[model samples]
Target: MLQVNNIEVIYMNIIQVLRGVSLEVGDGKIIALLGANGAGKTTTLKAISGLLKTEEGEVTDGSIVFDGKRIDRYGPVEIAATGITQVMEGRRVLGHLSVEENLMVFAHNRKDRKEVKGDIEKVFEYFPKIKTLRRQTSGYLSGGEQQMMVIGRGLMARPKLMLLDEPSLGLAPLLVQEIYEIIRRINAEQKMAILLVEQNARAALGIADYGYVMENGRVVLSGAADMLKGNEDVQEFYMGLSVAGSKKSYREFKHYRRKKKWVT
Candidate 1:
């Protein structure tokens, strides 16, 4: 249960990133926020996570409520303590820390030490590579492994709602699929609600129960993921083309190249 009221996030008074943004996440459903770069996806996540001090960005307009509690006013640590965790973009792992140590850092703050240890084992079970590299420094992990470690560390918190930002970014297609599959498993098996923010609209929509399309700052479309997936406008604009069985096609290839230009 997460509700983002008509919230506006402003930066430096000159820049406004999220404009009257509103959405909901029901129990066990994966809700996706799809948009291009600078579309306020990350800003929305930051606002929800309390990382963007509300007084600074100032949800000057609306409120965000989670698990029946008004959370828009709380700070990042407070939000995390309330069972909302964010695995931020770019896999922000502590490079100097060992894999196990990184997990232990989060676990130390949790309520149940025995359960935390059990969850650590469960995370390792989910990503065996992390277990194998327990003694290795995080800097040595591959991109996909780093992503797994970040997700695992978030799991250590036993969050009721997880805000995942671009879990598929920088990974190969196969790894992207692996990551999404794990997200699906977490929702299906663990019954965790998720607010997934991804530029990879196709993959995101494919797995999400519901989807929201955002542009510039506002939500342009919101509906069932299946409907958005079939909508021609979504395909031409946000999703581009289907990359089902084959490699990114000629048109898709060109679209990817053009997108990379802007992203870089």
Candidate 2:
């Protein structure tokens, strides 16, 4: 459903971030982009969603195509209308609005006015924890609730392709599990294509059909999710598991860097 071919993203016409990064999200398939902080995972999403232009970032090299249409030069609104919605990392929500109101905001552009309420109910179904809090001020919700609300809001747009950036950030382990399960269900039931950017390698790979490892703005590795899960380097670096299958501390390998073998 989406393709990013050798795209390089530059900010303010000077600072280059992405260097020949390319990946794909197949129809109704979950693709995971795994990397640590500052690996340009989020920037890739912005480029695909056309949110890069908002930060004075441009895809100066290569192209981004969605549903076979070239969208590298498109603006955020135009890209969104083409069935892409980015649920950004920060779990952003409107402080003053109620949870339902926050969700309703995304549907304003929809012509299906009557069905909007039904869609709200569908979102509630996916996130039953937020149903009771629908009329409550969103700012007062807990962090997990806020995260659920934001994902639900993105669902309001009924996007075909959802770019999820760091969805598990700052949440408890159990809450992370819950949200990831919901994301998996959303993909299976809605047949929505998802490009997931995450530092939590285990959770992302668990549901991903395929995966890519990024470093310093380039793809260092790419493989089927199961293959990545069993990889020694991936186990050591991302999962904190040693070759002996023992859990190791990040401090034990702080300076370790994987030898890059870029997928061609």
Candidate 3:
């Protein structure tokens, strides 16, 4: 399990980006962090995974705890080795490397060659298509394939928790559904925990056990996924759906949410 407690983040030690943002992911559960652009969803992930310093961003307040220990000061490599891996927003594969080679890079530090091979086979089990492209250049794979490959690479780490940012970003709807299915399977079968940050609210909430909605760098609303889904404000703002399938005027929707009454 992971806990982020009242954490504030700042960039260049000047501009504050996350204002007391907090959330949690329990063992074998999926938690969705949903918001529009500039809402600090990614900032929260960077804070947890210790990637903040790379961009001159730092956690200025509170703490991030993994399992039971504080992990706020650790570097990304140390964080990854602690059974947490981040699949960033962009699919960043080594373009020149073959798919298998790209995956091997994550497992390269381990001395157990047979275990590494079995892990690769396990990835293949979840992603049969990746097997065919094992020797092919990663740069040449389709966007959906590249996305699968990135998640497959994360699996090579055998993480207890996976920080997933925008996993369904540019893929087709069918592919998005397919990927979510596999994600659910991994959480169930592998006992993996996922902290999913996404702008694709519906898809994320569909699979998440709990959901948090952020606005202007703070958590405004959070609850059980089903409760958040049924919330009128969440329905109008994040979901783009309304009661009885009737559409509300843009002005009316804004007025309802901007009051912030629902959040209180």
Considering every candidate listed, which one attains the maximal lDDT? 2
> Among these predicted structures, which one has the highest TM-score?
2
> Mind giving the per-residue lDDT tens digits that candidate 2 earns over 1-264?
798999999999999999999998899999999998898999999999999999999999999888889999999999999999999888888989999999999897899999999999999999999999999999999999999999999999999999998999999999999999999999999999999999999999999999999989999899999999998888877898877667765666474555534534
How good is model 2 by TM-score? 0.95
- Each prediction's TM-score versus the true structure: 0.90, 0.95, 0.93
Angstrom error of the Cα, residue 199, model 3: value is 0.8
Q: Count the backbone clashes (under 3 Å) in each candidate.
A: 0, 0, 0
What digit string (tens of lDDT, one per residue) describes model 3 on residues 9-100?
A: 99998999998988889999999999889999999998898888889999999999999989999888788788888899989889999999
Clash pairs, candidate 3, are none
- How high is the lDDT of residue 32 in model 3? 96
User: Which residue runs does candidate 2 get wrong by more than 4 Å?
Assistant: 249-264
lDDT tens digits, residues 161-252, model 1?
99999999999999999989888988888889999999888899989999998887888888999998876666756665543523446643
Better of 1 and 3 by TM-score: 3
Cα error, candidate 3, residue 125 (Å): 1.2
